[model samples]
Target: MTTDPREAGPRPPFPGEQQQERPGLTSKMTPAPDHGETSYVGKGLLTDRVALITGGDSGIGRAVSIAYAREGADVAISYLDAEQSDAEETARWVEQAGRRALLLPGDLRDEDHCRALVARTVAELGRIDILVNNAAAQTINDGLDDVTAHDLEGAFRANVFAMYYLAQAAVPHMRPGSAIVNSTSQQAKVADSTMLIYAATKGAIASLTIGLSNLLAPKGIRVNCVAPGPIWTPIQPIAKTPEQIEQLGADTPLGRAGQPAELAPAYVLLASREGSYMSGALVPVTGGTPMY
Candidate 1:
């Protein structure tokens, strides 16, 4: 039986009535998200590769971990300390895919930790073939008055600084044909007033991707990015109020929020050999949200 992509799963609960501590757990979500546990089938597209993904404990990161494992890559997942439980779940899925799974728990906001993350992944997994900078943090702000110096600095530290730290550390170990996929957001292009800081960081990430691609091309390394739209993830409960969550993705042309599972294939494609010739590109998985 064939299924329409738009009608594949029940629309997520409007307003996600339940909320969890920041970096929420999948086990606590009202309707559990689909991470392609039973749906995605891999044909060894990334056989024998090693991947290091930040924020791999949940949301789009978890989905990417599962996809990479299924595609024959060992996964090293790094997440916040509070997300150990969620990280373990992601590791479980990766191991179930008949690949090695390493769980690194720490805050990526620290430059030292970011360096250590890369070192550990290389030490444990042998080498890093795919580096995914996916972890990010943001606070809701109504306007410039609501934004604090602490909030501004914190967002950049977590979102952009860590990416640079990880890249610097990982690049030395990365050989030709390696890929780096940074996670940007649709907000990078279509700025949201309330998400000013977060949007700015994403824009920085996009610029970094392009510039890095140019700088790394001579070394045969590819740098690219994925700009996701409103995807149902743990961040929603913490970032959006119940009322706002209720109307999530309503303005998107697709008329619904995307699931983490829906965003994994794009990462997989970009990381695989198929994307060897593709670099300095922004692949939008924004559910019809135009990047322009």
Candidate 2:
């Protein structure tokens, strides 16, 4: 039977579920996310390139990794050790696409590990032509009073600090045509009250992308960011209460949550030669929500 691609639509009401940990696994998500496994067609846009992506085990990161491999780039995916199974699954897809897939499992919060990850990717893959700093951490708090110092620090460490660490390590190996894509969020501009810390880190990432673009442009490197709107990923069930999950993405102008597959094209565009002139640009895939 032929499958209909358009049949995958906005998620139905989730029955209030939560993962026991942060950055939930893709294997456990209900009606598993679409990472363009059977869809994305490649025309060798990234032929002979090497890419290193953090948080590549699932969600948007996984989607981008798959797309990159299909586009002819060897991909090195880094993810938390707990998500090893998911990361391996992503590597399988890359291998299926006739590209090399390297799995680097570690915590990005550690500066040394971040540096090691870049070094290891270069050692294994030869050189870094693309870097996607897509890993992030988020937790919902009732209010500012409920926010703790640990929560604030953890968010920044995972979302912002890791980006800085990876970029610093990767830049030396990145040639003039190399690209760095950071994953910002719609919250970077909209600012959700319960997720203040997470939103703040994303705001910082947006600024970092612009600033890095200016700093790296002289060396022929491009830095840009993607500010995703409400996309259905494992982060939601873990970050939101069950009731919140049911209403997830309802407030968007499109009246639905986006799929992970929907975000890969933007990353692909930014990493491809087509986007050679695009730097310091913030591409929003927020289902019609204006970033301004």
Candidate 3:
């Protein structure tokens, strides 16, 4: 999705672009991320499919849940205990779309929790046609010496490793035509000074997406990813300071941050039959950021 500079409204100044902080939560963002409630008009691309989305409680995940439901799919949302009210709110939105919503809460850092997340979704929804590995964590540090081993492991477990754990459990229940959409980041390609660890995890996610697409090709399961630039979401508030938050995504050619709603369409397109012929691809929704 592209944001025009003339339409960017007022943007506040922030710190150096190279800094990284925390993975902000949705509740405290300056202007909360749009969950795509009003604009999306579903075309039944995912009719009768069951979608399991990790971190579906907010941000892009919540937007995708609503979009999928509007397309005639039942949804099962998995979230960490960090946010309960948001999860309930997201479920309500899904239900409002006339689709069943199941809430599964747990820590994805644990392999068992990851496995159970998919198992429960299948037990409740019968079969899983869409699995979104969107849950992740990141703690900003100065540089390599500042990154603790624990921090590295934590980021990996939540960002990239959990995808493997959850996919291993969910793939068995998936048949032909199922899709897996992993959330990568612009940092995967454009590295920042403080976000080295976080960027590394996202880079790993990109690699995993390509590898999984090949591994599951024979089984008719498609794997693709959306590498989003800065979209206004909770993760920003938690990860970056208020000043940094104010300037989010301004460095891009568009000179403004993106909204979660703007990024939702990419996930919808990838998960739905509209993108059936596409696989092993990375779709950049980074507001005119150069990727080559």
Worst 10 residues of 1 by lDDT: 1-10
Model 3 lDDT per residue over 1-292, tens place: 3255536433454332323234335665545567888778888888999999998998888888889999999999998775788899899988998999999988889999999988888898888999998877866877579988898898999998899998899899999999999999999999789899889898999999999999998999999999988876677766776567667777888787777777778998898878999899999988889766
lDDT of 2 by residue, 95-155 (tens): 9999999999999889999999999999989999999999999857777788788888888
Candidate 1 residue-wise lDDT, 1-292, digit = tens: 1367566654544745766678777787756777888888887999999999999999999999999999999999999888999999999999999999999999888999999999999999999999999999967788689988998999999999999999999999999999999999998999898899999999999999999999999999999999999988888878888777777777777777888998999999899988888999999988788989
Q: What is the C-alpha RMSD of each candidate to the true structure, in Å?
A: 1.2, 2.1, 3.0
What's each prediction's TM-score?
0.97, 0.96, 0.93
Against the reference, the lDDT scores of all candidates come to 0.90, 0.90, 0.84
lDDT of 3: 0.84
Q: Which model, 1 or 3, shows the larger lDDT?
A: 1
For candidate 2, the TM-score is 0.96
Q: Give the TM-score of candidate 1.
A: 0.97
Off by over 4 Å in 1: 12-15
Candidate 1 vs 2: which has more TM-score: 1
Consecutive 10-residue window with the lowest summed lDDT within model 2: 1-10
